[model samples]
Target chain A: MAIAEQLQEFCGERRRDLVRFANLQLRDEALAEDVVQETLLAALQGSDAFSGRASVKTWLYSILKHKIVDTLRSRRREVPLSGMSNADDEDEGFETLFDRRGFWATEHKPHRWADPEDSLEQQQFWQVFELCLDRLPARTARVFMMRELLGLETAEICQELAMAMTNCWVILHRARMGLRLCLEETWFTR
Target chain B: MMNCKEATQLMSQELDRPLTWRERLALRLHNLMCSGCHQYRQQMAFLRRALRSRSGGD
Candidate 1:
């Protein structure tokens, strides 16, 4: 099949995942749809650049990442402070995970997740992972995805989000703790 | 002694940047006696691997 036809088919298959990824980063449903649309259009126009080395999904994701970053940079000046304030501003919710003396609370203690590596091969595990990820606060999810999925550095994330380095670390720590607990509860223990 | 809270923070920070020797030493000491924290660190590492596997061709 020709590249154009292949990419059209790819668009139908991967569009939902791409939009979810963009929505996580942008936190705007409409903007996420627009970016994904633009990504597919760009891929179609530059179909010659569709090197066979990368899978179609991966290639589309790379394109989507650029589009999301561009949208973010363009909107940086006008982003309402309120939008960025709620996610990392307070530590009160996370504080309950520890006790007065800083020990893990009995109910919140981390248990051994047996054979976690095996879950990678299971489709159900990814479904649970997505659900847990969706439960995170929007800004927190964005920061975690930017760092872990997009492979951005701490300094870069801080700069992009206009957040303090310490604040960035706090958000990441919260994300990791929240995700670990969610996975343990919903997947590992079950 | 570093408590579980501090130790887990160090483990998460380790992913973003190199811990200072003092911080590393403190975490190392805490993990030795803290099974919960040790498990937490391992889970965080596992999470990272899982995410990278999904974001292939990056």
Candidate 2:
């Protein structure tokens, strides 16, 4: 098979993982789909020197990761993102996003009618969780979902997202910690 | 009343196992002292169970 054809097969096979990783990086599902499409196109064009240092999966992931960074940098966002740094602020950074001192306004207890198994036959849970997921910062939320929701191994996540294992652990730790804190502080306090 | 942090941590672990003797005792002692935390825990427990029953991950 031609290198481009082989690479196309590779990208097609791992499309789900690519989209998942891209979504984690970009936060917007639609935008992440775009990035994955762009990554595959770029990969096809550069197939001449495709090194075997990393698995094809990892190489594609690396490309997608850099693409997200490049996109963000082009937009000139001053705040550094989580996946960009192997060990920057870690999960501790998300805690600050919550308004701790302010009363958690829990007057209207909106129940999530989001049971995938219940709502749709074989429904994708992401569509449901994505509702609240949008509220979290892209990096912190992605780390949390990749670990807790998707059940991806921490080691794989560390390598894919370019996060340290400690940072990965800390990210999960803080995600659980921050979500509970924010929910209680914001929803119940009011 | 249990402080928000303690209850939140307790709830996270509770997803995997039923509260142990030590946890139950600690929680009991905590509830006697903190009404807000106690009520918070009760409500959270109900919410969690409702979610769990739907999740059926177990």
Candidate 3:
């Protein structure tokens, strides 16, 4: 099969997931669609770069990740930092998980999370995972996605987001804690 | 003694950068005595692994 035909077929099959992944990161449906469109067009033009070592889906996602990050960077430039800073303020909800003395609150103590590795194989588990990711505050989710999903270094993330290193760490911590709690409540315990 | 809050912060930081030896010692000591924080660290690690595998997989 020609690389173009292969890519067109692949895109037809995976476009929805690609768009969902972008929307999850961008939190904007129209913007997500635009980015995915850009990604597909890039993939078509650069089909030679599609080394067969990685699966087509993974290759597509790598392209989409860059487009998403580019969109985010340009969006950041347009918006005033002051307006976004308030949204990024540490959420007090995280503090509720810990007591005044800084111990885990009784109701929020971490559970053993029986056989978490096994859950990764389940389709339902991914649904719960996406829901948990969706529940995170927008900026928090973006920061977490940039670090964890896109595999950006903390230093790079700080520079890209125009945030202090310490602030980046705090946001990542909040994301991990929040996702942990959400998965426990929604999947592991259930 | 490092409390669970501080210990968990170090655990999360461990993912992003190398922890100082002192920070590592405090987290290790806290994890030794505190099962909750210990499990919290494990869950964080699990989250990272799961996410990486998911992205890298078809």
Candidate 4:
């Protein structure tokens, strides 16, 4: 097969996973599919850029990542997180667990999670984690994924989302707390 | 004395930026005395590491 034909076949096989991964980041199914389709096209057309340095999957992901960012930048104007009006309150319930002295209230202490490394290897654990992530409010989920998944810094998240630094931290803290509690209820406790 | 709230905030902050010696000392002392805060700290680290290693999850 020609290089173009081979690359097309490779990317086609991975299209579902690529689109799902994009949905995980972009959180919009339509946009995710759009980027994945664009990624396949870019990968097909930019064969010269492949350079034989990384796996085809890695190269495709890099293109998808940039495409997602570009999509985010274009969509940011409409998203308008500017007023800080949506001050996240999902954390309030968790706050009550910590007392005035900042100690855990009698029943609210975090239980020891089972061997997390073991859990990481379990496919179901990722499903639970992904669901928990989806449960987070949109802005908070975006920040948590950017920081944890994309490995973006706090500064970049603030710039991309047009959020204040302090607000970003607050959202992150709440996001973590929410995920823990969600996992406990859905997977850990069960 | 860093309360659990303050200690947890510092713990989350540590992920974003380097902590000062004083802040580090404060967190260490707090964790030494507070199992809840210690568990909270560990959970945060575990979550971050797990997500990072898994490439933000599959």
Candidate 5:
């Protein structure tokens, strides 16, 4: 196949992953959709020069991430966070994430939990997982999703968010805690 | 104060279960001395399991 044809085919297969990555970065499905479209176009246009230096997916992810960061930085312009919780965050069970109780409380174990990593392969499991994720504070939500859902490294997310190591760690912590609290209330009770 | 950020993060992992080596050590160290963190971890564990089931559930 021609290089463009081959690159086109390769990207088609991984389009969902690309779109998902962009979605997490941009947070708006429409904007993510636009980013994917632009990324695919760039990949297709540049295909003739593609020397296979890296796998197509990696290259595509690189393009998508840069495009996303550039777009976000230009558009955001330091607007203070809107404090908008998800309209669908109807699952109020995770509200404790916002509460300030015994957070440092060095007392009891609360309880012990079994592993759900085994069940994580299923789409439904991920759906609710994504739902809870959508509830996190936006920056925290973005950093956490990029690392956990999309498998970006801590350093990469830190760079993308322009956060310090400690700041990134703290965001990940809060994101995890919020998701944990949310997931426990929504998923574990059964 | 561990702050909501740190507490939330540590508590979140504990909820997810089978704590990492780092978390286990932290919990062990804190729980050994501080009764509060111990109970906190315990409650977090319970809350986590309960939430997990609900997640895979309807």
Candidate 6:
């Protein structure tokens, strides 16, 4: 098949996963779709630039990630961090799990979760996890994904979001706590 | 004496940054004595692994 035809088919097949990945990062369907489209376009147009150093999926995903970051930077002006209220800011719900001295409250101790390796292979587990992620406030979720999903450094994330380093860490800590509690309540609790 | 709350924060921070000697010692001493904090640390690691795999190690 011609390179153009092959690239077209490749992009066609990978579009959904690419868009879904973008949606996970950006949290906006329209923007996610737009970035995915741009990613596909860049991949196909620059197909000759493909060095074959990485798999097609990985290459496409790298492009998608760049596009997602670009979209995030552009949209940064519209969504200020202060305007993105944290869902957990109203209460120290997780703190109640520990006593005044910092020990786990008897009733609030964490239970051992099912084997993570097993759960990672289970589609239902990811569904529950995704739902929990979706429940986080927009800014928190974006910051979390930028660090965890994109593997961006703290300095990079702070620069991208125009947020302070301390503020970034606080958001990340809250995101982790929120995710932990959400998973415990929804998936781990029998 | 580190509590579960502080230990959890350290656990989460460990994923993103290097822990200071004081924070490490506190968490280590706390985890040594507390089964619940140990479990919390394990769960947090599990969460990071899950997210990394899903992101294709991006």
Highest DockQ: give the candidate number.
3
Scored against the true structure, residue A58 in model 5 reaches a CA lDDT of 64
| Top TM-score hit | 3
lDDT of 2 by residue, A93-122 (tens): 533432353212344222332232343233
Segments in model 4 whose C-alpha atoms lie over 4 Å from true places: A1-14, A51-56, A82-91, B56-58
List ranges where model 2 is wrong by over 4 Å.
A1-3, A10-13, A76-173, A176-190, B1-58
Q: Candidate 1, residue A107: CA error in Å? A: 3.5
Provide the overall lDDT of each model, using Cα atoms, as 2-decimal numbers: 0.84, 0.54, 0.85, 0.78, 0.58, 0.80
Residue pairs clashing, model 4: none
What does the lDDT come to for candidate 5? 0.58
Candidates 1 and 5 compared: the better one by DockQ is 1
DockQ of every candidate:
0.68, 0.09, 0.72, 0.55, 0.15, 0.66
DockQ of model 4 vs. true complex: 0.55
Q: What does the interface RMSD come to for each candidate?
A: 1.9, 9.8, 1.8, 2.8, 9.6, 1.8
Q: Candidates sorted by TM-score, descending order?
A: 3, 6, 1, 4, 5, 2
| Clashing residue pairs in candidate 6 (N, C-alpha, C atoms within 3 angstroms) | A102-B3
Model 2: how many Å of interface RMSD? 9.8
Candidate 5 Cα outliers beyond 4 Å, as residue runs: A1-14, A48-55, A78-115, A143-168, A188-190, B1-58
Per-residue alpha-carbon lDDT of model 1 for A1-190, expressed as tens digits?
6777767875786678778777767878999899999999999888788887887777877887788878877887787444665655656377888999999999888889988999998989989998898888767887898898887899998988878999899889989988987898899893
Error of 3 at A152 (Å): 1.1
Error of 6 at A68 (Å): 0.8
B-chain TM-score of model 2: 0.58
Query: Residue by residue across A1-190, what tens digits does model 6's lDDT show?
Result: 5557656765676567667778887877888888878877887779899887666666776777777777777777887766766664565476688788877889988778877778888889988999999888777898999998887898899987777887888889989888988998998884
User: Candidate 2, B16: how far from true, in Å?
Assistant: 25
TM-score of chain A of each: 0.82, 0.45, 0.86, 0.82, 0.63, 0.86
